[model samples]
Target: MRSSEGMPFSVVTGALWLDLVYTGGEGDRSCWEALHTPTDVAAWAHSSGVVSDPSAVRIDEADLRAAHRLRETLWDMANRLADGKLPTSDAVAHLNAVAQRADPVPQLVLRSGVLELDRGRNADGAQVLSAIARDAIALLSGPHADRVKRCAATDCALLFVDTSRPGARRWCAMSRCGNRDKARTRRRFEKG
Candidate 1:
């Protein structure tokens, strides 16, 4: 959906790990390169909700490489699960290794006189990736594993976690692929 300012909304797949995968786009077409530089990775970390402040996070060339590797591995595994195939043992091992790299240190903070658990602003690239990988582990191994799906649009292969009540979601975003498919179908019917 476009905002009042006429900018399209950012589509989130209900999970940060899946969000990372979508950054690479589908097939030969790329949405945009969000990990081209260490600075870009830092910005993505903040925008993707991996960190609170982009400036506070330290991302280096090595970190960028690691992020790219983890993202591709995750995309492959997610697509496999969506296609009713089991993830390979090697992919599982890589995920485990990334997740064990560095976990974000959680801090209990007092907000409005209530205690809340939060990953504070200060973090490194490895910590950001580990958090994402850890989330992937939980999602792949958890009850919602079967809910993973690729968009039904023939040309769009974005993977998403189907959190609908009936688990019947067929589009990455209704405003995008879903609407396009509906319009195409209507046109075909008119032609008939």
Candidate 2:
């Protein structure tokens, strides 16, 4: 599905990480946009694994609003962490409020001879949002917080955690920002 910015929706960086990157930038030129409708939010929720099934849950405008708020908060928090500063109080408070709305409980179940962990039934929209908020909080406070980085593509504003062994990752996704940057560099050299 397309993002509100008309860009194709991206999930390469991880659901709670940069799924909402499509919603930021300067005004007018900014891609900052909405999910369009509640069904779009529901589809995102399901595709991102925020909910088990899009068909099983009903998302409303309120739910989409909440998700937007949480997504913005997460983006702010991540940028703060990347800049070596604590997130603003408003960001922390928003995350806390959303995180309290749902708690994921893991259950261990035996399947044949192996025991596996399952998160149980699908979460509602609020719970799905909570899960994402909690994940952002964890990333902000966790050891990998230092690894968060914005894309190196001059035109891309997406952020992602550098999980590479050397921590030298530079793009949100190789096929997207990485390839674009490479092509631009190649054109510049060819002109020179």
Candidate 3:
């Protein structure tokens, strides 16, 4: 598995719903640059754990486009939630269309003395997109709907679920936005 660092997707959000929104950053810091080609899509799917076997999955330009479109819709929906407003009707419809596509059905199997659940061996790009759409829907309608938030960093547009006990998480990641904000605060104090 590839680390979140250097990958086109940010896995630091701790939830697939937020991670999908983080795919395209705010302003000019977008991370979907690597998703322009089929090969890049395959790499991102593998790194993001969207597909268990990247070697067997096939992707094309259409699939890449659909994935990007879904990413954008998800971003819009998440942003609306962060603003304490409902997701746009178009965004909901788009998510529903993707969610109704080829979704992976998990099956339980007994291997030796252990029982394991699997989404089958032939997971494809559509299935991955469907899974992400379902996750977004769940987050939008679930109990934690009010907990979804955008990062506090002035220039960062990443979204995250505030999973802390007190629900006071600010930055997307402590090592990234938190550290940067702290440094800026220290500089301001020194100047004062």
Report the C-alpha displacement of residue 80, candidate 2, in angstroms.
2.5
C-alpha lDDT of residue 44 in model 3:
66
Per-candidate count of clashing residue pairs (backbone under 3 Å): 0, 0, 0
What is the RMSD of candidate 1? 3.8
lDDT by residue for model 1 over 55-110, one digit each (tens)? Answer: 87878999989988888888889889989999899999999999986765667889
lDDT against true structure, model 1: 0.81
Model 3, runs deviating above 4 Å: 1-11, 25-32, 105-120, 187-192
Query: Using alpha carbons, what is the TM-score of model 3?
Result: 0.78
RMSD of 2: 4.3
lDDT-based ranking = 1, 3, 2
RMSD of each: 3.8, 4.3, 4.2
Best by lDDT: 1
* lDDT score, candidate 2: 0.69
